[model samples]
Target: MQKSLRVGQILYTNVLPVYYYFDQPKFEDRIQFIRQVPAQLNQAMAAGEIDLGPISSFSYAEHASQYVALADLSVSAKGRVGSLFLFSKKPIEQLNGAKIAFTNTSATTVNLLKIILLKFYDYEISYVTQEPVLEEMLLGADAALLIGDDAIQAKRNSHNLHVYDLGELWHQFTGYSMTFAIWALRKAAIADHHDLIAEVHASFLDSKRKTKENPAPLIDYVHTHFGGEKEEWVRYFQGLQHDFGDVQRIGLEYYYRCAAELGLLAAPTTVDLWQAGGRQTKTTLTR
Candidate 1:
């Protein structure tokens, strides 16, 4: 018999479709949801604490051998994922060597920022926790990376902060969408129930129909799931974009190339994505 599935998810607002899925009695018992921040989610997955979860794309590349991406989901906008913010009291260039505040909330975004800053921006800044206070970052640092709700809240400040959205930044640099989170599974576990991966992707598409039209129901679902402030979560979900779009999406290529450039992967290649009707075969990355 197949083992019961354990699922993990980040508590971010972009995951409403997955949350709404629990409404279906078909999946409720078999699939258990582990509500956690992205950073913790990835660690748990790496440590084998959970079998499946929406892992940050960076982790997929970092720990490629351990996990295989099951379904494409939780991507950032091409030109604007407002939730990812790079705030600086000083300019990026000016902050040569400083302590940068990082939201330890997400591994992918944190690593992405680190790579971008080190490789492209030439910023030699160390990452510090977002807690204790923003005041700490302000006093002892050059900039801060605040993501999700924290980023949203920081953006509202009256102070002048240079906010560089990673999606927009990557699009301007590479002309491709940034996929933030991907549904990933333990590679060993995928052999027997690969069909279930397809089903989950199908399920995401079906839920999108109900969610794509009206924002209220999805928002309500988020509020119920996380016990968060409803109106804000609704507006945030309304702003997010979630179309995996037939598998030939530009985001996958961007991921491959970036991974290669970082020497995380040997080469770049197209991902052979599968839609609802068939079992998806894994695509090797080659340039």
Candidate 2:
């Protein structure tokens, strides 16, 4: 019997379209799946708890020495992702020096929010990390940052708060897609089990393809598990870009550059996407 590879997954509605159906017995046996939020997964990957999963892009940079990105797989958006937002009592410009509570479950969105505020708007704000409850996060703070399912739910219930989609803000400022998460594997794991890594990568790609072909599985999933209107679930998946193609690569590189300049990252990191057969490949493209 082949050794099973442990995988981490983000337990959110958005990821359902990419990974939901794989829960069937066929794929489950080979994959020892551990579900977690992005932040926890990031920490787990760095600590060698999970071999590979979709991790926050910012955390990837912080742990660049330990991981290599899985090519052609990412959670990104051109604009208005509808799942990562800053809800504020006042406009962004008016909130200088105001306290903003961010979701402790994310790293990419927190850095993205800071990059948008400091680089584009020239605004400064203090931040506190908290659990992603819109009401609880908004208490004692002028703004609250929410991501994934919490953000979508908050958008539905919010009437008076100013909601700024971080994806849209990044695109408006930089004209590139905002890559929130990337599939990353530990360097040593990939080195030790190239074939297993390839199998895992193909499994994710196949899952994503099947989900896109028939969205009913995902819609039904959110309806049964999350309790939402089917159409709303459909729209949420429609807003996501799961492939890290050339355009998305440029967007990701631009994001890294901006994050490095803003001191969110130690330095601008290279996009060394993983390849089958234990090869580490870096693609160069002109933006």
Candidate 3:
């Protein structure tokens, strides 16, 4: 008998649409789910604790040599990602030499913030990583960057302070959608468990399709578990882009280029997208 594949799942509500149906009976015996925040999941993926799952795009880029991305799955946003925010005591323009506190729960957004500040905005800023507590983060720094549920709640209760959506900022800076996370499969796992990986990828695609056809169940789940208004959850789901198609690929490649130029990555790497038939295609950087 083939062993169950270890799959990583992000604990944030933004990923619900893709994973909403993963608890179904078909997946129960074939898959084992490991839930964690993006940062932890990144570590797990790197440490070989999980075979495949969605990881920070930056994490995928950094280890592009060891993994291949699923061509049809991603966590992205075109203009405004409702849950990724940078709350500031002052306008973003005036924070040239300011201190910014970042949530320790993220890897992609942390580096993306650096790219935005140092590369795009030409600001030389210092940063510290702290727990995802906005008020506490703000006490010690001029601004705080928060992602996932923490950012959502912070923005909801926010007043007077300026809240900048990182997705929006990225879209404005570059005319491409921003892909925050990608589904990555370890190369060793793919070599050993090709059939299982294909089945899991199909399950992910099916779940996303089902969610897009009827999002009411997902919204209700978020409302019951996460305790937010259904309308807000509705808008949040609507704003997110889940497909890793041409647009998302372009955006991710551009992000890799920018990150490499900023010294966040050792060098630009090809986006090796996994194909179901045990073949992978390398997407060379356009620049």
Candidate 4:
């Protein structure tokens, strides 16, 4: 029997469409899907606990040498992603030097928030990682960064809290879409299953196609499994994007550039993109 593929999946609603098919009994023999938050999945991929899955964009930069981008899929947004929000009692300008608690469940959004504050908003603030409880995070701090399902829930119950969509903020700061997460495969794992790459890639693409073709099933699944009004969930899904095309690639590269400038990495690393046709491309970069 062939070895089962170990796949990591982010439990965020934004990614459920891609993960929908994996839950079916047909895929059980071929794969083992591990659901986790973005940060935890990143750590798992880095530690080789899982073979491949969507990972935080910032974490990919930090671990670029360890994995390869599985082109054609990502969790991105043009603007106002709804799940990545910065809630504050005061305006962003007034929050300079303020204590802000960010969810430890994410790394990309935290870094992006810092970039927004320093580069665009032009101020330095103190940030600490904390549990993703909006109320608790804002108890002693001026603001809190909540993301994924927790952030969505916070928005639903937002009473007097100033909410800023990080996706819109990133777009306004830089005229480009934000690629929040990318499906990355462990290099060694992929190499071991080189002959099966095309089959695996096609399966995922088919799943995404099925998801887009008829969103009713997905929305129903979300409502049943995740709990949200159908109308609200529809709008939320509409705002999210998963195409890893040129536009998203440019945006991701720009993100890496900003990360590099912030000293997050020594320099922008090459994106090893696995093309849809099962070909590999080494994307070179400078600055």
Give the clash count for each candidate.
1, 0, 0, 0
Please list the residue runs of candidate 2 whose C-alpha ends up more than 4 Å from where it truly belongs after superposition: 1-3, 27-29
Q: For residues 7-119, could you state the per-residue lDDT of candidate 1 as single tens digits?
A: 78677767766656444476666666788878888888888777776877677666766765554455556667778888888766677787788877876677667657766
Clashes of 1: 1
Once model 1 is optimally superposed onto the true structure by TM-score, how far is the C-alpha of residue 112 displaced, in angstroms? 2.0
* Model 3, residue 275: C-alpha shift (Å): 2.1
Candidates 3 and 4 compared: the better one by TM-score is: 3
1 against 4, candidate with superior TM-score: 4
Per residue, candidate 4 scores C-alpha lDDT tens digits across 79-193 of: 8797999999988768878999999999989989988898888787887889999988998899999999999888888899889999999999787888899999888887667
After best superposition, candidate 1 residue 192: deviation in angstroms? 5.2
**Model 2: per-residue lDDT, tens digit, 27-101?**
566668889999999999999989999999889989888889887789989998989989999988798889999
lDDT of 3 by residue, 53-155 (tens): 9999999988888999987899999999999999999999999999999999998899988999999999999999999999999998999999999999889
Relative to the true structure, candidate 1 reaches a TM of 0.80
Model 1 C-alpha RMSD vs. true structure (Å) is 3.7
Report how far off residue 87 is in candidate 1 (Å): 1.7
lDDT against the true structure, each candidate: 0.67, 0.85, 0.90, 0.85
Each candidate structure's TM-score, on Cα atoms with residue i matched to residue i, is 0.80, 0.94, 0.97, 0.94
Residue pairs clashing, model 4: none
- Estimate candidate 1's alpha-carbon lDDT, on a 0 to 1 scale: 0.67
